[model samples]
Target chain A: MLLALATASFRIESSFRAQFWFKLLSGVLNVIARVSIWQSVFLHGAGSTDISLPQMITYAILGATTFSTWDATQILREIGADIRSGNVVSHLMRPYSYPVSLYARQLGARAHEMLMIGLPVLVVMGSVYGFQLPASPGHAALFILSLLLSIFLLFTVSIAASMIGFWVMDMLALEWSLRGTLALFSGGLVPLWFYPDAVANTVLYLPFAWISFYPLAIYLGELDLLSSLLHLLYGLSWAVVSAVLVALMWRAACRRMIVQGG
Target chain B: MRQSLSLYLYLIRLQLRTRLQYRASLIIGWVAQAFGYASVYGAIWIVASRFEKLGGWVWPEIALMLGFHVLGYALGALFTLVQLRRMEELVRLGTYDTLLVRPVSPWAYLVFSGFNIEYGGHIALGIGMMVWALPQLGMDWSLLTVLQLVASLISAALLTGSILTMIAAMALVLTRSRYLFGIYFDFWELSRYPITIFAMPLQFVLLSVVPLGYMAYVPIAALLGKPVPVIGEAAPFTAILAGPFMVGVAILVWQSCQRRYQGAGG
Candidate 1:
């Protein structure tokens, strides 16, 4: 049933051919902007001697592609709308879990986007800026594991954020705050390596690190094999913790809905 | 023109009154917008502080550029946000016909009906940056310079409004063209930084093709005694013309597209 929902989502997304082109164009343009900013940074010889231009370029490419899979803002907005219109109540009537089914549908759309938009962006920008390969095959395999964990981690966090809509009427404000936090803390734009030691040390331990920092760090060979494995374990723990939190929040939200007769 | 101006103000007043009903959300949205923009620019600032400069732009100078970009965009968004964002909806619902049949000029009517007072946060942030950054730059604040700065800001607003209006015009011909705004925003992201950071070809595209440089970089550069791309010393003067030129172009495109807009069959 979930598979059917996902497939339907993929088909619905594919039908919007014109939107696909625009999305692809924007994705590609975004990578270009990122690359230009980094190029100028390195060209001017700013920052420390540790990180190189190639690594920053690769970070920007991956930041725009593989790691950019989900959009927390748009998803939260949808959830908020459902709550506002009392559409969420109907979901509870179904046998399947609402969050899981929503995830499945989003997964289908994201899969389509990654293939259709993400790959093109990666190839085009990667070729233009010379995208860096993984540190080694061992690291490459580890990066994939971390990437999967990050996806789950991000989804749980988003779900937890969405649960706020159960109480707050102002979802738009909530959405922006979530987006701001994600963009800054996720290391999706500037790598934590270049961050001040004080910030880098603190952010390295945060759950947001797994979203883009740790996976990209692992790929770039910033973390050795022993540390990569350790980081992946840490990321998994964060994801599990977030999942539990999301479940608790979901339960509370459902209770609130019933109490209010939504 | 005076009549249209008054009509626009009256319509905007109505929108403001309606919007005032949601006082709590309005304040919350404002705070969120301020925080959102702060983080977005904060990321760039982090990178800049680490590197000390970007394309020869120090953090202070970049702040000024950001000021212009945000202020101009906020001003433009006041008139064009509705058209740019909801054009597809209007086209989809066949509301274009309703707009056309109204006694007032549809252009003014459409522009003001969607008046976005939500950009108050952006305007405040923009002015704050400009005010904060100006003293740090040590640039002369002559009367002429001040006038030029004000004119340049107006030009930026016009250019931004025109660009969004042009994109919204596409909805008239192709109702599902909202995604083109994505392309515009992609460029907008690039504009937040120094254009000199981009390759020459991209810089050219930003200048002549899209004229985004006029939106912030060129005018700011000229004001700071930095060499303006291509035009050099005459950059600020040329920047003044950008608003009128783009407005003319946007009007032409909008008119032509509306003429071709057959109603979405009910």
Candidate 2:
């Protein structure tokens, strides 16, 4: 049954060709847009960017594909809305933890997205601009670990962001702000290596980097094995810290919900 | 026509007042929005300023491009983006049925009713950026150039509004299309940079089919006397004409879609 829930997203994708088109077109636009920005820099402003033009294209395509999976912002917005309207009570009374169940549901949904959207977009994009595979099997294994780690970190952030429903009347403002912060810090738009020295260094250490950037960087062989392993540990540490925060927030949210009982 | 205009204004004013009632949400939403935009342009600035110029555009010029992008979307947000965004919600709540029974055109009413005044702040912000960037870019703005700039902006907003209306109209019939509409912003993200950077095929699509040039690049190109590759400077003139033309087509489409409306709440 849980497996069916995971594959449910694929059902939606299969029902309508429109969703597939939308995701594909959007992903293509993302790559084109990123390439355009970088092409300008590398073609005319090459004196500045450390990453080669080809590398930037690879990064953009990979970065956009991250959304082919269940995005944190969507999960955060849905959960926030559920909590706000006390729909969370339905889940709260269940045998399992609400967040845990959410994790289960979303993980399944993401699996569907991976097959229907993520892989197909990569194949299309890879054919167009070409994709860079891992340099070695070792790097390939490391990339997978980093990618999974990123998903874990993303969930932590999503949970923390969703907790704002305890206080805020609307989730749009909170979601918008969190997305902005995430896009910048997570290297969703531009890789951190291109940011100014202070920003690059600071953002690199933040949990956000693990969400998309570091994993893609690893796949590109941009990080050495030792550095990749070290960063993976660092990412795990951030996840642990974030999970603690999520627990505290969940407790507070429960208290708030009880006080504002519907 | 006058009656319709007044009714539209009245409806917009009503929305404005409603939005204002939720003052705290409005203020916080705008700040988040501003920060969202700031980070995008901030990163662009940091990277673009690293060199003398990018694809023949200086850092200050990039600022102006960013201004056009924000200002254009800000206009859309004020007039119809938020309303269009909520069209799907209306379907679920059966509120869309209320619009159908209204005396005015439901298409116009649905498009104009939700006036997000917060976008006004963003427009004002864009203007501030333009003021700061214009002087440094050292462009000698002639009267013709200024006229072209205004016309270009109108073209952009009209073009975008029309495209959105068409999408919304289709979504009204095919409810799933609404989710497709949500992803439409990614298309606009294409306009943040000059069109010259894209390959020939993409340049054709942006110029002819979708016409993103009118949104960001064509106006700047016309102002700076730079030629828009493939289509030339006259590409914006196409946008100017297409804008109102598309609106008419969208209305025609919306009317047909309404004929096919299943009256939500399955």
Candidate 3:
């Protein structure tokens, strides 16, 4: 999944700049290195006995992917504008699904962001800060899987938010507020661990937690294989539930569609 | 200048009346915003209770910083809402022509147009926090201290207004560069802590390059009787003076950018 996302991002970025793809690749690597280095310094100061290096890297990558999803609302806003301007009907008449096409485009864009922004930050962090590597190959593989799950969870939430535009004329305010809420709740800015225990306990049950922190925790080996599997199951459940909700909303919106009298 | 000042006051009044219409939403938004910040600060307070201080700032000192931070934020929120939103709309529709056609200076019209009075709630809440925290800090009731606080707040307001205006001017030149403003907010977050906590290089960057220090740090330092080399002993005066200087620079930049405006749409 990461490879696919990285490739798509590289392709989109390349369209914008000849050297962008290479630069993005190198940048991501640099971020990882830098983050790893920073963690080493932190570990040295705090002592390495308690925290896992590989887990921190995994968590950081999860954060980067979640942050990259911010563009989803911008894409939705563009679509909403097209609808308001009477351009959407023509696109709807085409053989392709409008929302699906948007998802594809967004996926492409997100891939690019993950590569250009996420990867570089990760590499820079690793090299500059020095994080602890995973204890074993199995742990590294588990971390990778957890990250994949995190991406899927984030996509589901973004798509659900964007789907609100099917009925609402302008979802900009809603989109912005939802994005801010998600960023705060999903541990995108600060880790959920930093949150007050009372609030953290309440937020942990929400779907937003699955978008970033759960997968991150899993990768960090904070959770065992069974716990990681449970997290993935919860994430998949939310994805399915959100998809169904979006489908219902889209169907109702189509029925209520009153194209303004031209 | 008298006529323009009158016009600006009228414009501000108009904005306030418009905002008054949405009393319910305004109240709700105010509560939501306050709760949001309260939760974050609550977390900080909880963590601080575990340790005496983090990075040399005690709870009371940190609370003061928080007060100033929220005050600057509220002041920015109250003034910049219209300018910030219109920035995108102006770029997309090229409707800045409307402002330019006005009798008053386009800069004043643009800057003062959209006042979100809802932010007054946040400012009020900040003042409440300041009042509550002051007694805990063992502050004596003195005329000099009161004067210093008022002066510092005015200076902080100027510093924030100037920074925002500068960013808005930059938006006029590079319409899509608003994300840079988000990066700027990250710097604002750093200012929630004492300047002395950071390494010398970062301290220099925040103090000199961004001048975020002028917004809260220098004034607070002055209040605490700490030495601030940039503003010196008369930090309140220096800080207040900094606002007009920065705003002057911002206006000059805006004028230059206006000359270069190709207009977004035909």
Candidate 2 yields a Cα-based lDDT of: 0.75
For residues B172-239, what per-residue lDDT tens digits would candidate 1 score against the true structure? 88877778887888888888888989888888888889788898998899899898776777898977
TM-score per candidate: 0.96, 0.91, 0.79
Q: Rank the candidates by DockQ, best first.
A: 1, 2, 3
Error of 3 at B140 (Å): 2.5
lDDT of 3 by residue, B1-266 (tens): 99899889998889889979877656665665665566556645643443446445567777777887788667765777447655756777767767778898776786676766767556866887787777787766689878877766776676677677666666567765454455556577667666665556767777777877777777766666667654467666665566666667767876887788776776
User: How would you encode candidate 1's per-residue C-alpha lDDT over A197-249 as one tens digit per residue?
Assistant: 88889988999989988999999999999999998998898988888888888
lDDT of 3 by residue, A72-97 (tens): 55765676677677787676567765
Highest-scoring model, lDDT: 1
| DockQ for every prediction shown | 0.79, 0.59, 0.15
RMSD of each: 1.8, 2.7, 5.3
Docking class of 1: medium
lDDT of 3 at B30: 68
Q: What residue runs in model 1 are displaced by over 4 Å at the alpha carbon?
A: A258-262, B1-5
lDDT of 3 at A222: 70
Q: Is candidate 1 or candidate 2 better by lDDT?
A: 1
